[model samples]
Target chain A: MYPTDCRYTREHEWVRIEDDTCVLGITDFAQNQLGEVVFVETPEVGHVFDAGDEIGTIESVKAVAEVYTPVAGEIVEVNENLKDDPQSVNEDPHGDGWLVKIKYSSSSAFAELMDAAAYEEYTKEGK
Target chain B: MVDFAGWEMPVQYAGVIDEHRAVRSAAGLFDVSHMGQIRVAGAGAQDFVQRLTPNDVAKLAPGRIHLSAFLTPEGTYIDDLLVCKTSPEELLLVVNASNAANDFAWAAAQPHPGLAVEDVSERWALIAIQGPKAAAIVAKLTATDLGTIRNYGFATGQVAGKPAILSRTGYTGEDGFELFVEPADAGAVWDALLDAGAPMGLVPAGLGARDTLRLEAAMPLYGQEIDRETTPWEAGLDWVIKLDKGDFIGRDALVASRARPLTRKLIGYEVVGRGIARHGHKFVSGGREVGVVTSGTFSPTFEKALGMGYVETALAVPGTALEIDVRGRAIPARVVPLPFYKRPR
Candidate 1:
């Protein structure tokens, strides 16, 4: 189960607000669906990206998928620990699995994302 | 559900990685009913099988299963199958699901007099219970003494109050058993095994986990690591072929072919980078295409990537430098001896 404090995107990424910056990570559902994550290519700090831009890549045992930024922002921090321990996403997806921190264009972008209950309904609808 | 060889089957019940870990650390059950089963019975059954396979089928004792291959005239593999000698005049051949139709047709067309052949795939269902805890779990539900069942051996027994054949063999490189039961009782037996073993960490595994486990064990898959154009010697399966066996299908060709060294040999590779190599990927050595990947996957147990492919026999030695073509980018790889991982003996 995901905490209600974080906002979710339709692609299953979750954004948690911390001070003026927002931290981004994949949802538990996304990690579970991908199986064992063998490697994670996190975007470097100081990299600028627009909403829905490809920022990184995640490779599993079976295939590879691109991770996209949900909001326009510049990367302030990247998860360096993921390079040596990509299974962090499988072990603790919400905490240590945080991928990057970005300073968004506006704080109101959070309102455009789904809340926990809404995201639950969205995932159920997909079934 | 995922489509596997024309059959719709679940990749996993809980999830693939979880199921794969469960199989490695504990135990997992698989519903492999989609595999094909063919029966050969008649006065000339033994002679017919000996002529069809490259292996010496006449040497098999009752209830023993031997891994053998049906080959083409040019010594190319038709299909790799398990031939069980149930009686002097009766044999059961189990084959891969995707090759059932072609294998059946090929056998029917063979000119073996007084041999009766029948396709029994629909009449039976197969389940594989594999892992470290497999023997204990199976022993609880079956009347047979699983402790005495040696590897590659089988016995007729009762499971879940129904008649079944229990074989001490599995795709996972662990102590496990494969149960063959009546099709009508498959679902009940499956539920019974899960109910009895759930508390011990048993889960319903699927093809996704199966593929990863087999990859870790370095088992070859048909259509990928091998096909009609590949010979047993080239695929590293010469151990199953008996060249001394008098006159069999492709024997003359295999004998004549062995006089020359194999050009390409299958070898295992461990990926050293972030990329995952997949089927049809090219292998580069000294800046040229030297081989092709057949089956590759990230090993769940090792938490690293591994693959099996055919390379020039000269470069088949372990520790040879190689590169895998991943998304058009060359990723460094090295030829390693199979299997990439194995349980302590």
Candidate 2:
């Protein structure tokens, strides 16, 4: 189930505010669609990027998908465990599979994102 | 589900990596009914088949089968097919689903008296059970002696109380059987096989696993590895060409192609970088485009990104360094031997 506290993007990324920074990760639906994760390439910490920029790549056995940032921010932390155990994305997309943490420049972008209910509807329509 | 050559096929059931590993360690069942079947019968069947393909059909005795190709007069592939001889006067040609209609038309256009080439695909359904435990599962439901049928050999028998043509052949690099049954009995046969093989760790697989399995075996896909523009000599399929077996449609062209040195050769490669190289990705050396990837995947068995592609002959040797342009980033890769994985004998 999608967490209520998090905001989602149509591209299947989810972001949740945590203290001074927001954690970013792909939604459960995206991980299921991509199958088992064989590898993940995350942006290095301190890398700055704007909204909609491709911040990382997720590779499955048969295909590859790009993960885009949902807000303008500088990457503060990346889940280093994904480098060795990429299956975390498929095992627990919203938790341990979190890709990066960002310190954002604007709170306005966060409000523009969809809530959990809206994201579920968007994915249903896409089906 | 996805439309594959007009047939709605599942891309996976349990999962690609799961089913792929099952096929390598235990067993996996696949519904391959989308493949096309063509029947060639009558007095001139053998002669007509000989005239059409590059392989020597005379070597295929009754109950025998061999892989061959239907080629244009220019020696390019029309389709790669499996030729199965039920008897001297009758043969069955299994063709790719994507090229079924075209392949049937091409065969019918040839003038061969006392022979009839008919598209019999709709009347049949194919199911393949592959992996180490496949034979044991098949033995429980059929009267056909598993040991009696050699690789590429087939026999008519009853499977799950239905008429079937059981062939000891498969596209996967593992020991397996392909069951050809009537369309009405397909469901029953599939269910029976799954039921019998379940305890043995057989899982229902889909097209996703099928592709990865074949890629690991280094088998050529029609649109990817071999195509209308590619000759057999260039695809490493020269073994299928019988130049001295007598006059065939592409004999002269194949002989002529063999006379010249090949400019490019198909080779296997492993990506050394983090990303997986995909089909149509350009292979570069010193910023010069030298080749293009034809098929690539993260091999579940080898746990590495492996691919096959056509590269300049000089760079086809193993250990040669190359780079693939994945999107805009050039990823490092190295040429390896064909067939990234082989089953233990």
Candidate 3:
């Protein structure tokens, strides 16, 4: 189950707004589907990105997936702890596994995302 | 259902990784009923098997099993199978799931009479319980002393109150057993094992984990590593061939094969890049493609990508620089020795 307070992208990434900065990470469902995250490539701090841009990579025991930015912003910081412990995503995807914290240039980009209920319905149809 | 060697089978029950960890740390159950089972029974059963396989089956004592291969006239491999000498006049052969029909047709075509060959794959079910704790969990439900059965040995026992053939062999390279039971009793045995092992962290594994485990053990997959074009010598399986044994299929070719060194050899590789090298991927060396990846996967034990591929004899040395083409991108890799991970004693 995912937290209801966050917004989700169609790719299953969740973004939680905290103050002026927003935290981004994969959803619990995404981590489970990937299976045993072995390597995580975190974006560098101070990197600027827009919506739907390729940000980083996540490799599991079977395959690798590219993480994309859901909203346009500047990357203020990356989860440096993931360099030594990528399995943190498998353990806690929402908190310890957060990939990046982006300082948004405009808050309106978050409004374009789906709410928890809509994301659930969307994931059901994709399945 | 997932497409595995042209058969639609479940890749996992709960998930692949969870099932994999269960097998490594505790116990895991696998439904390998899709594998082919054949019965060869007649007065000349022993002679017939000896003529077909590369191993010295005539020396196998009753209640013992030997890993052997069916080869073509040119000494290329047809399939790697387990030959079980159930009795003096009866033998049971277990083959890969996808090669059932093909192997049956090939065996029937052999010029041997008075031999009754029957495909009994549908009548039986195969289950594998593998892990370090497999014996303890299984012993609680069976009367047989599992500790007495050595590797590659078998016994007739009652499992979940049903008669079954228990063999001390597995693909995971763990101390475990494979159970062959009647179709009606398959579900009972599965449920019983799960119940008995739940407290021990038993899980129902699937084909995905099976592939990784076998790769880590450096076991060659039939279609991938040893195919129609690959001879036993090239695949580093010369130990299975018995030159002193009497005449057999491809014996002449195998004898001659020993005289000449293999031009190409199967070697292991560990990818050192951001991409995975999958099967059919090309291995580039010296600005040209030199070999093809047979079986590749991200190893759970080593936490790295590894695979087996055919490389030229000169480049088969360990630490040789190689590149694997993954989705049109060249990823840096190096030739490493086989058995990427070994269990600690």
Q: Name the candidate that leads on TM-score.
A: 2
- Which tens-of-lDDT digit does each residue in B271-294 have in candidate 3? 988566778999999789989999
Q: Quality of candidate 3's docking, in CAPRI categories?
A: acceptable
Among all candidates shown, the one with the greatest lDDT: 2
Against the native complex, each candidate's DockQ, computed on alpha carbons, is: 0.46, 0.83, 0.32
Off by over 4 Å in 3: A1-10, A14-24, A42-55, A68-77, A100-115, B1-10, B13-18, B199-201, B251-260, B271-276, B286-288, B325-332, B343-345
Off by over 4 Å in 2: none
> CAPRI band of model 2?
high
Docking level for model 1: acceptable
Query: Candidate 3, A80: how far from true, in Å?
Result: 3.0
Per-residue lDDT value at B126 in model 2: 97
What local distance difference test score does each model get?
A: 0.87, 0.93, 0.87
Each candidate's fnat = 0.58, 0.89, 0.37
Scored against the native two-chain complex, candidate 1 gets a DockQ of 0.46
Higher-scoring candidate on DockQ, 2 or 3: 2
TM-score of 3: 0.85
